[model samples]
Target: MNYEFTTVGALIGLAVAIILIIKKLQPAYSLILGALIGGIIGSGSLVTTVNTMVSGGEGMISSVLRIMTSGILAGTLIKTGAAEKIAEVIVEKLGEKRALAAISLATMIICAVGVFIDISVITVAPIALAIGKKSGYHKEALLLAMIGGGKAGNIISPNPNTIAVSEAFKVDLTSLMMKNFIPAICAVVVTILLSTMLSKKQGVQVTENDLEQKEDKNLPSFIQAVAGPVVVVILLALRPVASIVIDPLIALPVGGVVCALACGQIKNIREYAEFGLGKVVGVSVLLIGTGTIAGIIKASALQYDVVHILKMANMPAFLLAPIAGILMAGATASTTAGATIGAQTFAGTLIKSGVSALSAGAMVHAGATVIDSLPHGSFFHATGGAAGLEIKERMKLIPYEMCVGLTSTVVAVMTYVI
Candidate 1:
C-alpha cells in the first residue's frame, strides 16, 4: 500500500469509528466497520482487508482469554456479597465524617483487586449513596469519588487494560503493575482531594428515594471475603516475589474457586461462572474489534507519519506511547480499547526507540486513563445510572476524572520517561 493512501485511509477510518461511536453505535460494530473500510482503502482490495482483520483479531486471542477468565473472580465477588462486605468494612472504619475518602479508597481497592471499573462503581454506589445521605454530601460527589478511585486502581489492575498492554509489550504483568503503582497512588490522592472539595460545594442531597432496600442474606466473614483476592494476589506476586511462575489464566479461576470455597458457595460455582461469562462477553467482543482496527493501523503508514512529526518537533521518543494512548482512549471513550490499540500500534516503535518494554507499557496504560470517561463510552452511562445522576450532573464530573487521569499520566512519565 502506498504511504499517502494508507495514511489517509487510516485517519479517515479512525474518524469514522469515533463518529459512529458518538452516534451511539456499539463500539464493537463501529470498530469492525472502521477496520474494514480502512483496510480496503489502504490495501485497495477486499480480500486483503478481510485477511488483515482476521490476522489482527487473532493477535487478541490471549488477551481475550485472560479477560474471559477474569469474569469468574468478578462474578464470585459481586454475587456472593463479598465485594459489598469489603466496602462496608472500610466505610465503617472510616465513619461518616470521612465518607468521601472511605468510598474512594474502598472502590480503589476493589478495582485494583480485579473488578471492572464499571462494576466497581455499581457495586459501591449504594453504599456511597447511603453515606452521602448521612454526611450531607451530594450524590454527584460520591459518584465522582468512586469513578476517580476506580480509574486510579484500573491503571495498576490485573484488569483488561493492564492485561492488554502487558501482552503487547511482552512484559510480566506484575512488573507492569508495579511500574504503575506510584502513579495509581497519586491518582487516588487526587480522587480524594477533588471529591472532598466537590462534597463541600453543596448540591442535591441523597434522599431515601435514591436508596435501595437491602435483602437479608448470610454475608461472608471478613476473612472469607478477603480470601479470594488474597489468593489471586499471592499467586500473581509469586512470579516476582518468589520466582514461581503462574499465568493469570490459571490464577484468576483458582482465585474464584478459593473464594467460593471460603465463602461456602461451592454449590453455585456453575451459576457464578455463567454470570461472569455473561458480563464479559461484550467486553471480549470489544477487544477483538479493537484488535482489527489496530491491525489496520499497523499495516498503514500512519505510525511512520506520527513518528516523523514527533521527530520534527524534537519531542522525546517515549512521548509517543502516552500520546497515542490518550488520543485513542479519548477517541474511543474506552480505556481498554484505547490502551490495547495504542500498545499494539506503538509498542514496537517505542521499543525500537530505546524505551524498555515495561516503561512503554506503563506509559500507555496510564495515558489511557485520560479522557476515558467521556459520555460516548458505557462507563459514563452505566456508572451514572448506578449513581442515579442526571446527564448534566455526570458531565460536571468529567474534568475531575480527567485531572485524576492526568495526574497518573504525569507520574508515569516521571517514573519511566524522566
Candidate 2:
C-alpha cells in the first residue's frame, strides 16, 4: 500500500462519511460505506477491505457486550419508576422557585448513573414541563436545561461513549471517569446558570396542554429509587478504591438486579432486560460501524499526517484528541460514535506522541460532548420531541448546548494539558 494514497484515502473516506451523515443517512450505514470506500482506496483490494472491516468490528465485541449489558440497569431504572421517583424527589425538595436547577440536576443524576442521555431526557421531560408551566419558564429553557445536564453527566457517566473511549485507549474506565469529575461539575454549573438566565429572559411559560401525564401508580420510595445506582457506583468504585476489579459488563447487570429487587420489580426483570436491549441495539450497531472506520484510519498514514501538522503548528499534543472529538461528533451529531471513532483512530497516535492513555481518552470523551447535540443527530430530534418543542424552538437551543459542552472540553484541557 502506498502510504500517501492510504492517508488521502482515509481522509476522503472520513469526509464522505460525514457528508452522508449530514445528508440524513443513518450513522451505521454511513460509517460502513465510508469504511469500504477508504479501505478499497487505501489497499486497492476488495478482500482486504472486507477483512479490515470485519476485523475492526470484531474487536468491538467486548464494548458491544458492555453496552448491551448496561441496558439491564437502564431498563430497571426507567421501567420500575425509580428514575421518575428520583427526579420527583429532587424537584419537590428544590420547589418551584428553583425548578430549572432542580430539573437540570435531576437529569444529570439520572444520566450519571448510567441511563442513556436520550432516555434521561424523555424521563425528565414531563417533570420539567410540569415545573415549567407552574414556574413560568419557557419550554425551550426547560429543554435546554435537561440537555445541558445530560451532556454534563454523560462525560463522566458509565455510558457508551465512556466505555468505547476507555477500551480504545486501554485506560481504566473508573479512572477516566474520575478524571472527568471536575469538568462534569463545571458543566453542571454552567448548565444551571445558562438555564436560569434563559428562563428569566424568555418567560414564555409552558402551557398545561404541553404536559404529558403518566399513569397514576405508587412510586418506589426515595431510598429504593436510589439504591440501584448506589449499588452500581459502589461496585464501579471498588476498582479504584480497594484494588478490586469489576468490569462494567458485570457491575451494570448486577446493579440492575439490585435496582429491581429494591423496587420490588425483580419478577419483571426479563421484561426490563428486553426493553433495555431494544434501546441499545441501534447504538451497538453504530459502534461497530464506527469501529470499521477507526480500523481503516489506524491502518493508514493519517495519524502521521496529523502529528506532523500539529508539530508544524506547535500546538500542544493534548489538543489532538479533543479536536478530533469535536469534529467527529459535530459531523455525526452523536457523542458515542464521535468519541469512539476519535479514540480508536487517534488514541495510538496520541499515546505515541507522549500523552497518557487516560488523558487521551478523557480528553476525547469530553470533546465529543461539545457538539454531540447538533441538529443532524437523532438526539436533537428525540430530545426536542420529548420536551414537546417544535423544530424552530429546538434550533434555538443549540448554542446553549454547545456552551455546556465547551465548558467540559475546556475543563478537560486545563486538567490534563497545561
Candidate 3:
C-alpha cells in the first residue's frame, strides 16, 4: 500500500544484505533481516513489513514440512546401513577406475525417478563415503559429483518446478515431462562429467581417508537397502498410471517404514525421523525466510520495477529464460522457488511472444539451476554436512557448481538457439 519507496533504496538494501550474509550472520537471520531492510527502504511501514514476514514464513510451513519428512527419510536411510549397502554394490560393480562417476550417476538415477535432493543426498552421502573408503577418490570431488547429479535431478525432474509450470501454463504433466526428458538426460550427464572435472581442477586433493573399509555383505541386501527409496520413486511415478495422487510426504514415509521393517530398525524409527528433522532446521528456516523476503518484495515497488525492467531488457527468449531463473534462485536459494517464480513472471510472456514451451522450460530449468548452488543455499550447506567438512573446507565445492551451471546454461541456449 506504500507508494513512497524508491528503487535505488531497495537496491541498496539488497546489496548491503548480501554483504552482511557474506560476513557470516546466521542464514535465517540474514535473509529475514535483509528482506525487512529491503521492505523498509521500499517505503513499507514497520507494521506491514512484520505482517509480510509472518505471512511469508507461514506460507512456507507446508514446504518446510515436506522437507522435514524428507529429512526423516534421509536419516532413516543413513541409520539403517541401507544406504551403505547400495553404495557398496554400485562402487564394487563399477570397480576402482569408474567408482567416482558411478556414485554421481547412481544418485542421478535415484533423483531422476522423482526423489528430492534433500532426501536423496542424505542417503547417497553414505554411498560417497563408502566409495571414498573403497577407492581413494578425493572427498571433495566426490562431494561435487554427488551434488551435481542431485542438483540436476532437482532441476530437471518432474518435481515442484515442472509441476508448477504444467499447472500455470495449462500443459499436461506428461507433455512437460516429454519436453524436458532429453534436456534432463543431457544435463545430468554433463553435470556428472563436468562437476568431476572442475572439482579435480579446483585442487581437490585425494588425501588418504581413515575410514574403515568394511565389507558389509552380511548387512541388509542391496535390494533390501534400496527398497524404501525405490518404492517411493515408483509410487511417485505411478501417479498417472494409477490416476491417483501420490504425495512425497506420504510415499517417502511409507518407503521409510518398509526400509525400517526390512532393516529391522522399527524400534527407533521415530527417533531416527526426529534426528533427521533436527538436521534440516538450517535449510527450513532459510527457505521460509526466502518466502518472507519474496512476500515483502511483492508488497514493495520492487515487483513493478522488476517487471518493467524485464520488459525493457528485450533479450532473446533463450537468454531471458535462464536470466529469469538465475535471478530468483540466487536470491531465494531454491530452484523450485526460482523456477516457479520465473514461470509465474516470465514463462507466459515468453510463450505469448512465440517461444516454444519446451525451449522455455529447458532454459528456465537450466538457468534457475545455475545459481541454486550459491554458497549460502540449503544444498551447499547440505553437501557440507554430508561431507563432514567445515565451511572453509567446503569452499572447493563452488567451482564445480559454477561449472555445471555454466555448462547447463550453454546447453540450454544451444538447444533453444539451434
Candidate 4:
C-alpha cells in the first residue's frame, strides 16, 4: 500500500476552483480553469491539457445530452400548465390535511420519473408555488418540500444517477433494484417527516406574488395531464426488468410529445422545447467542466493516490463507501461523479475487505446523494431559476438534505444487517 498525498498541484487547483466558486464565478469557468491548472502541473504541456479536456468534455456531454430530452419534457409540463394542474390535484387530494405530506408526496413522485433534479425543480416549482398560494403554508416550506422530495428520489431512483451507478457496478439491474427499492421507500417517508420538523423550526421568507395570480394558460384536464409524466416515470422504473427495458432517452421525448399535443401546447411546442433547452444550458456547461476535472484527476496520479488511501484507512467496511462518496460528490458538485468515480477508485480495497459488490454499490448510492446540490450543482441553479430564488436565498434547504443523506447511509448499513 503506497500511501502518498495527491500532487500539490492537484490540491492547489481544487482550492482555486472552490475559491472562485465562493466568489460567485461561473462553475463552468471555475472547473475548466481548475482542470487546466491541474493538467499543467501533471502533464506540463498546454497542448496535452487541451487535448485531454476536449476528449473528456466530448465523453461527458454524450451522456448529458442523451438525458437532456427529459429536460424538454419537464419544461413543457411547466409552460403548458400541466405541472400546475398536477400539483393542484395532489394538493386537492390532501385537502389542507397534512399539507407537508401532500407537497412531499407530489415532489417524490414527479421527480422519480428519471429526470434530473434541476429539471424536476424547473418543471414542478410553478405548481408548488400555486399549491403554496392556495394554502396558508409558508411558501418557503412548500418550496423546500418540492426540493426535498425530488432529492429523495434523486438519491435512489429511476433517475440517471441510478442508471449511472448500475452501469458502473456491473450488477444485474434487477438485483441492485431489489437491494435498494425498499430502503428508498423508507427514505421518502423519513424525508417527509424531517421536512415537517425543520419547517416548523425555521421562519423562512418567500416572494410569492406570482404564485398567487391565476394562471390563464390553456390546460388539460387533471387526469390527462397526469398521464404524461406518470408514463415517463413508469417507463423508467421498468428499466431493470429483464423482460422489458424502457429507455428513458426514448420515453421522455415520446411522453413529452404526447403531453404537448394533448394539453393544447402544440401551438407553442417549439417555444416550450426552446425553454427547456435553455434551462439545461447551465447544467450542460457544468457537466462539461466536471468532465474536464474528472479527466484531469484521472490523468494524473490522483487515482492511484485515492485508492492507496482507501486501502490503508482505518474505517469500517460499511462506512467507507458513503464517506468516500460524500466527499467526492461534494467536491465535484455531481452525484454521478461521486458515486461512479469514488466506487471504482475504491473497488479493490472494498472487495478485499469482504464487502459484496451489491452492498458497496448501495452504500455508494447513499453516500453520493447527500451533498449533491452545492451552489455549483445543476439542481441548485435550476431550482433557483424556477423558484425565483437565489443560491444564498434557499440555503436553508441544504441542512435537511445533509440529514437525509446521512439516513441513506443507515439504509445501506441495514441492507448489510438484514
Strongest candidate by TM-score: 1
Alpha carbon lDDT of residue 102, candidate 4? 80
* TM-score preference between candidates 1 and 4, better one: 1
lDDT of 1 by residue, 157-221 (tens): 88999999999999999889889999999999999999989987867678899998968868898
Candidates in order have lDDT scores of 0.90, 0.89, 0.65, 0.66
| Cα distance off (Å), candidate 4, residue 240 | 3.6
TM-score of each: 0.98, 0.97, 0.77, 0.80
Residue 16 CA displacement from its true place in model 2, Å: 2.1
* lDDT by residue (tens digit), candidate 3, 159-201: 5555544544555454455555555566667766765575455
Against the correct fold, how does model 4 do in TM-score? 0.80
Note the clash tally of each candidate. Answer: 0, 0, 0, 0
lDDT of 4 by residue, 1-418 (tens): 3421245556566667767766778877887898788778664478877787786577565446545775677667767777666766776798665777787766766666445666666666766666555555564576677777776667544454555455545554435545766666676677778767766664444445656465476667887677677676566556665447766567776777777887867788788878877766666666667667655655566655555566589545656667767877787677765665556445555666787878877777778878877876656676766777656766867887777777766787777867
Which regions of candidate 4 fall more than 4 Å away from where they truly are?
1-7, 43-48, 122-136, 156-180, 205-211, 233-239, 242-246, 264-267, 316-320, 333-362, 375-393, 416-418
Residue 209, candidate 1: alpha-carbon lDDT: 93
